[model samples]
Target chain A: MSVTVPSGFRASGVVANLKSTGKPDLALVQNLGPRHSAAAVFTGNRAKANPIIWSERVIADGVVSAIILNSGGANCFTGSFGFQTTHQTAEAVADALGVSAGDVLVCSTGLIGVGDQEFRDKIINNVPAAVEALSEDDDSAQLAILTTDSVAKTATYAGDGWSIGAMAKGAGMLAPGLATMLVVITTDADLSSVELNHALREATRLSFDRLDSDGCMSTNDQVTLMASGASEVIPVLADFIEALKSVCSDLARQLQGDAEGSSHDIDIEVIHAKDEHDAEVVGRSVARNNLFKAAIYGNDPNWGRVLAAIGTTDATFDPYAVDVSMNGVRVCHAGEPDQPREMVDLTPRHVSVLIDLKSGDATATIRTNDLTKEYVHENSAYSS
Target chain B: MSVTVPSGFRASGVVANLKSTGKPDLALVQNLGPRHSAAAVFTGNRAKANPIIWSERVIADGVVSAIILNSGGANCFTGSFGFQTTHQTAEAVADALGVSAGDVLVCSTGLIGVGDQEFRDKIINNVPAAVEALSEDDDSAQLAILTTDSVAKTATYAGDGWSIGAMAKGAGMLAPGLATMLVVITTDADLSSVELNHALREATRLSFDRLDSDGCMSTNDQVTLMASGASEVIPVLADFIEALKSVCSDLARQLQGDAEGSSHDIDIEVIHAKDEHDAEVVGRSVARNNLFKAAIYGNDPNWGRVLAAIGTTDATFDPYAVDVSMNGVRVCHAGEPDQPREMVDLTPRHVSVLIDLKSGDATATIRTNDLTKEYVHENSAYSS
Candidate 1:
């Protein structure tokens, strides 16, 4: 029970034959609510997919009755015909659920530029079947949205008489401002759309926004939150925000653990910076450095590469006054070798790199994965 | 006859036992000139090598009498002792050539943090042998300054009455603002240091500055030009600049061809941008995109990745109006799939990606290579 874990929500997953493997490839989630409040965030990439464009319009009015998502084709760079297909899918969902078409959202993921007439017909024909299969405690919706992911990611937060349930799917192309993930969250809290939007932005900024795996932004990424007044619990705004942040961060770590062909989950933390932005900039610079990532894959504590990477950023810091530590061992002190690199064990799957700028009091962390031969192989053979 | 192809230059390569392979690892070049005028550039990375820090002071007076370069150990992050080692090496060269230590520039390349007492002793002990072996026509200096490179890189430009000769060594870490390369250029033309500086800056800006094989910048990168005025004939400044540009561009291509663990040399050209900077920003974004690079490695014309890459930049362009062509096939036209991707051929060692930003009339090109599994292997096994 992922999206349907919350009360007043029904979800179903069905096989639409969008994938050649005959796996479940379509999902539908409906809100049987006294209040139809919703908020969403799309990919920051300018070249958005057709479904993303349609969903942005549906979410503008802060009311969503249902959402229909598909796997197999991203429906991006497919021109006006693809946009028509997304619109038709939403209209089908509205007709089946007896809701306004303007209040239905659409999402798609997989290969780009693959939307055709057959793709449109398969989704439109399955709407009725998906609506009939909806249940109050179904976990199939979590399985229908994965493309390259090895597992389903779901997180739940039980508050005071209120709960939030979320499911996310992504395996690669994870970077800042969100990855190639499609997420849907449902809550039984008595909250308005405006309040939900405020909480979601702050939550995602500290969670998904710090994950820079591979540093590749996607063209089709969406995270949505829907609220139903079933619980009638008017919780404190601060408490709600903290709960939401916890769920998002949990899902983000799950995504990192399942990233495509990755061997190590590395956390690059920057401390003693001029500000939060400076610390983030410094951490992101190291996170995106391919040479440094490859070194981590080889289990080499190459602190010099870290220095070289951070040197490229405009963040305020003295290159010679910085310190670097791996795990719990300080490898570099004041930009010189301290502990022997052999003392730092990197055989574990989790690696932590600590960088002290020795400037101020701000700090941040960026999560990334190592570069490996398997990573090159997976991406090289992805389309072929 | 690389750097010695021009007049008034004597160079030699000697064994210093710095490398485990028992190969020549030290090189010395002297400007036995009537007039010594030099111009040089170092890496823009803030975490510079100790040699770079010392050489910067030597080139400040626009006069350089000699330059010594070594391979097998980059004198970086070795503490103040590393700076002392660099200074001692320059002093050794100055004493041998009967010049001021301030007139000698030094360069080193290899694994960072490897300069120990033994490393310094080996270099200092071999200075006398290197000086005694110097000759005007020897090419040993070209062979000595190589780490992971498979071939010696040399380029020559013969003007009406004067000529320019240059040699460079770098196989990885090639990026904008120069790579991990150490270059030495010699000319017999009659020119002042001010004139040489102007021409060298312009030449490098259009040549090596556009070669971004990987997005990694190095802490030890330098390019130096020394004019001897041996020909005693002054040429037009514009003609000299054009000749230098040609030589630098030729050498840059050679570096791209020999880039470590690369199979295909890719050239991403952005056309009709708002300005040159925008064109460069757009081209470099695609050049550094690992997804696009891996797609090219698989010989797949995935144009959607190209659109997604350029969309990440702040360049002036409408994503919907862009066109992407691989080789001669326009795979994506006006943001929609036009020609099929199967029509494009990528079997050759060279691949071209053309992006038409239909926003203005400016254009730029960036050179890069495909991301391969061998790259991971080479870098992982390095510094071991």
Candidate 2:
């Protein structure tokens, strides 16, 4: 159903004056559970945000009772004061929720190097009202944690006894480095924190880690999985892992679809490589090729750019032995022209670009958004 | 002074019908010299163009009598027929110049996967006319190698009894994996092939290799230096290297200035890194950041994007100890805001961004272009 559909969870959102537009800028999600346990992943970028730096330590012991998120400032590279802002915000949230300050996770997204003392004070003062308004049916929490995204992203995959629910927010700086953006997934399934960590890693490794809508990696990306253990039904690890991956993949695709100013969402599948890593290398190269992405946006089947992108990688493939297909019409065969470029229809929102290395039996798929004039305009329009 | 300024060199350009625009599509530069020696560098892309494959072996012995360059067809990934086309083009140039095919270097630019039979015929059939029209004062050669470039890039360094001249063509796909795009530099100094190779490597290492305009590596990049040795002056090695580097750097800047659809030419300087490599790592990371580039194009002093960009690199630096300056105003100090955002003016084409790593004394500069709507339009307008 929704993020709040999971057992023993309540969410609410309030206007904290963090954003000048007067939109909801503060959000809270609490685990009112029989058992409180969580697993989380963060952006691998070394220069992380203050919130990420704080939550990394908070999640180390694998217990999280509440989460506070904001979309006004990333609170990244904001110096020691910004760290204090993140710390005090978590403390305020813990006080409101009757939880330990160390057991709260904080997430932030917006312009980098923001979140000064004034920003911190606004979040702390509004936290009590956000906590008082918490309800299982409130839909505003998901609306408050978006920076540039035009739509809210949420997904659910229910099993026979328990269900997993997820929410994410990102439209730019979406790249693959573990979690590409800020996300939260809640479940009622009974599982230990260790099992949740293992399953989260495997799920995100195959899902969010493969979604590279843009080549820009954010500094505040975090994906946290909180389990309430209120369903009283322990599921098989294999099934739980699959369900978690499905939800993550759903959110990943939603993020890709809402990428900033993108005209088309491209799925680059690199197959027949020497190994899975080689396939991933080739896929990422294609994903990062601005020329190829622009051509896709223009509905032009420019296979040469694809080959040129592939040439950038160290994947095992003879230059003359690779093949490329657009929408199942082979434009390049054995590194030469196969089908005419006019036959490939690319007007749809979803585009598939398949590259065959003809080296070994391995495959990888990378999700990306096409580079368009609108994307350029949207990203360059304002400071945010 | 132009590429023809070098002693014992003649240049000309002609229309071979290779380009549909009927512009000059073929260019020739010959060394009618007493001593013929040369050095060259090709693109590091694994899938190289046919001309690159041919000229690599032709310049093996460090002797080059003439060069035949064409626009409107990169002749890359055109299968075996493209290789044959390059081979035949060299032979045709050799037949017209009264030299061995092994002594002629061939260069091509334009769309990849071209150089089919018709395209190759246009080149092979026009060699005699191009040779007959060769004149030192024709000055059409530089105009022939341009594709998508708003202006021709040429530079000359006059010295005591010796000179160096060069011409380059690239508005896109200008990344550092060897010298990006097509360039030919001629020198009249009496240096051996070994000395020329060493000097060329050292000179280009600091110039063309530091320009990363669009972060797209080309498949047909070539930088060739032909020494006529006509001016029998054996200049000091260090002085000649400096002058050569000056010309290369001048050309690199011109390419950056004329980058496709760019309104701002961004110069990112990384200072106080651990070493030159670390400096380069930090500088290039900032140069390749689309968010930072877009902000520059928007005339916004968004220093946070700069910090976020450098954070992606593994260069030795504490994130909190960094300082970023825009147009001489320190916008960020100790990873916090310092100067006002309105203090920086990006209305001019030349924008300077300085990042102080506070790690060491090493420094490096990277030249890049801002991403704009016109860049997206031009790149997506045609298959090239």
Tens digits of per-residue lDDT, candidate 2, A1-384, equal 357878878898899989988999898889988878899988878788999999999999999999999988888877888899889988988887788999999999888878888888888899998999898887988888877788899998888799888788886333443123788899999988899999999988877888877677778889999999888889999999999989988888888889888889889999899999999899988888878888888899999989888898888999899999999899999988888999999999999999999999999998888989887787788686
Cα lDDT tens digits, model 1, A296-330, are 98999988889889999889999889999999899
Cα lDDT tens digits, model 1, B69-115, are 99999888888999999999999999988999999999999877788
lDDT of each: 0.88, 0.86
* lDDT accuracy of residue B379 in candidate 2: 76
Candidate chain B TM-scores, in order: 0.98, 0.97
TM-score of 1: 0.98
Backbone clash pairs for candidate 1 read: none
What TM-score, over all chains together, does every model reach?
0.98, 0.98
